[model samples]
Target: MPAKRWNELSPRTRKLVVVGATVDAVLRIAALVDLARRPAAEVRGSKRRWVLAVTLLNSVGVVPIAYFLRGRRPQPA
Candidate 1:
């Protein structure tokens, strides 16, 4: 969006946008850090592919959450 349009938004709207963006950035950073730390053998799918997806896909933490939940192997009992 244009800078003028952004400035025209109410303070509440600006605050919400900033908060949401900060949360998303934190999620992305955390996901990347986890991916780097996780053992390759523990990841269920292709590790490289998942890393690319979580890094490239900018969908408000959805893809990162999916990786943490579904793309990793279950721990041994």
Candidate 2:
């Protein structure tokens, strides 16, 4: 049989997971929107570069939060 719970997790871990998921979703959506609005020809423009950079930064930044979320949940003695 599969385990029901892998022990109780600390409050911090739960927060991290939720925040990471949320941020990642937001960044991915923004990137998609940016790509859809700007055509290939327009990508050379400064505005397009800025938009792409911001999207990339957000996506990369979310990794740390994900790690914290992945941390093992502590079990009560």
Best by lDDT: 1
**For candidate 2, what is the lDDT?**
0.52
Worst 10 residues of 1 by lDDT: 1-10
- In lDDT terms, how accurate is model 1? 0.83
Deviation (Å) of 71 in candidate 1: 1.6
CA lDDT of every candidate: 0.83, 0.52
Which stretches of candidate 1 lie above 4 Å from their native place? 1-4
After superposition on all CA atoms, what RMSD does each candidate show versus the true structure? 2.3, 15.8
- Per-residue lDDT for 12-65 in model 2, tens only? 777877797787777556555655665554443354554555456645555333
Off by over 4 Å in 2: 1-7, 44-77
Each candidate structure's count of clashing pairs: 0, 0
Per-model TM values vs. the true structure: 0.82, 0.46
